[model samples]
Target: MRCSTPVPAESDKLKLDWTQWIWPGPKRVFSAIEMARAGQQPWPKSIDYYVYSNVFVLLAINSNVLARGLMHWAALLGLGLSWLALWVAKTLWREPTRRRLNLSSLATAAVMIGAALLLKFHPFGLGPDLERDDRKALTLIIVAVVTLAMISWFFLVLIRSQQIAGRLRELDEQALHLKLARRLASAQIQPHFLFNTLASVQHWVDTQDPRAASTLRSFTSYLRATLPMFERESLNLTEELQIVRSYLEVMQARLGTRLQWQIEVGAGVDESLWLLPPGLLLTLVENAVGHGIEPSLRGGSIMVMVTARPAEGQVLIEVRDDGAGLAAGAQDGVGLTNSRERLQLLYGERAHLTLTPLSPGCLARLQIQTLEPTA
Candidate 1:
């Protein structure tokens, strides 16, 4: 069966209103705040929540020395400064260079100095009545508040930097995987392979051979399955096996009786439940045909097997050929290298691909640990 790609309807496309373009920043900020409040972590218990709460408590405790209006103004100013500090930390996190870090430090120092000046001058026209001892105490309070703000800003920047680094690493891995997928697709559909297959089809057609129609059908099916396979991140074993079967059939048609192949599934194996990186199995089969069988004087049989181990939570796949064994000092080609890297990216250390040389042939085995279906 062929896998069909889904296309979204016209109504499914994103349609933005005028507010989305005009007030995008505020809308996104509010939306994010709402999401944070509704998330698994309690918003009230966050570090920022505690920090701001402490600042307000300090302002309220000293309300006797300062006017009520002045206290409110100071509270608002502190909140605004905290927001600015957070914005600056996020900006620095995106591009954490030495120069940016130095500049942010200077900016933070300037903000603290400005806050002290505002408090001393009573800019809100509601000055605090204080004696010599009271002034000293107020000065100490300002120092403590500044120190707290500075420490909070430092920790905020540190946390943001770590988060940004992890996000960037994930993006880099995804980009590398996509690059390898495209390269493997190109390698599989090389001009020489296509030209050779077409040449065989043309000969059969010219000689009015009966195999011409079936050969063309298999070639069409192979193209239909392969063209869209790499566009996706993964495929179920059933869809991948269809591609493999079509490929083997086309090759068999070209080689005539010299090429023989069979696919075997263990009794408990459900092909649809097993998901794999696209074109992974196809690469192994191609290796078997090109390196293991085609190069030999008498082309031999290729066996593809899929077995599931429910108790062990693993799936084993093997592609074996009773043809020429591995040549001495032969390094892995682009296909095998790309396959290994793709497997590593997908399954980490839980999946392994090994090529063992038998007495008369070569065996390529792949074992993947998977308990549930991962699509």
Candidate 2:
């Protein structure tokens, strides 16, 4: 049977949004696209297209070649006026939504329609009076048709712009989730480290430290407590502490009674808080055991302390082990090296885990910058 990995008791805050049952992502994008189309302004090229389809062509079909020439000139003149009017109207009404695009089309459509209306009813429109009322009527009808076409075109352009914007937003959200998952995975499992743990514990069957044998049992417990609670992206302090406890139990077998452990947690540092990076505390605990506790052949105690600094809105954790301490050459140390890299990736400069040696032992202090206040 395939094993179903269980998530740790990190924070309940990381739960799926149980509050609002929102629309699916694609549908939301579709709605945004539709809205953008409704709200967007027109482009200048759209104006040109509208003018070509509406005013110029109507003049082309309904008038004499000479009258059409004058109307074409008038339409060009009106197009400039329309361009200016649209720029002003959009500024006063639509604001900068279409600030960059060519929106001269809106003005062109407006001006051409107005001119067409005037030309249709006015007796002396654009040229000498038409010989027949029928000719004038047909000319008027054509101008009206162009005016309608220009308005319809502008709305269509707005609708298309909205659809494009919605799709872009959807893609952006998807990209963000992929990036978060990548970072989470990189921070979690360390195969070589796991292999080393078994080897290191087994290397000594009956060494002076009788505790080494029992460490195997502690390792087993640590694995049982930690592996089951591992979540995809994050975990709470409560879950992390369980991993730490099991690890410390196994480590006590190596250090024997020489290693004493203490944990002091302040109030309001809630278990459900989502602050620390996954496997961060593991690295800290491991480094304490590896470089701090194991080196002092006489054995030493490790104090894992945690406190809430509500004034600063941060959580401070200290892992102190009374061992030989870290060497200056410890820069090559893998546990601290990997721990620091993981911290930088997850919290940038906001979160920090540092290894410093005391006269008695080495101390790994971790400061989580943000406190997701318990609700």
Judged by whole-model lDDT over C-alpha atoms, candidate 1 comes out at 0.72
The per-residue C-alpha lDDT of model 1 at residue 365 equals: 98
Candidates' TM-scores? 0.62, 0.53
Prediction RMSDs, each to the true structure:
12.8, 13.7
On TM-score, the leading prediction is 1
Model 1 stretches with alpha carbons more than 4 Å out: 1-139, 142-187, 372-375
* Each prediction's whole-model lDDT (CA): 0.72, 0.60
> Per-residue lDDT for 31-116 in model 1, tens only?
23332333222223365676677768877777676545545655666566666655665554444334454566666777667766
Q: Write the per-residue lDDT of candidate 2 for residues 233-324, one digit (tens) a residue.
A: 45677777877887777655544587777676777677677555566777777766667766667777778788888777678988888788
Model 1's number of clashes is 0
Give each model's clash number.
Answer: 0, 13
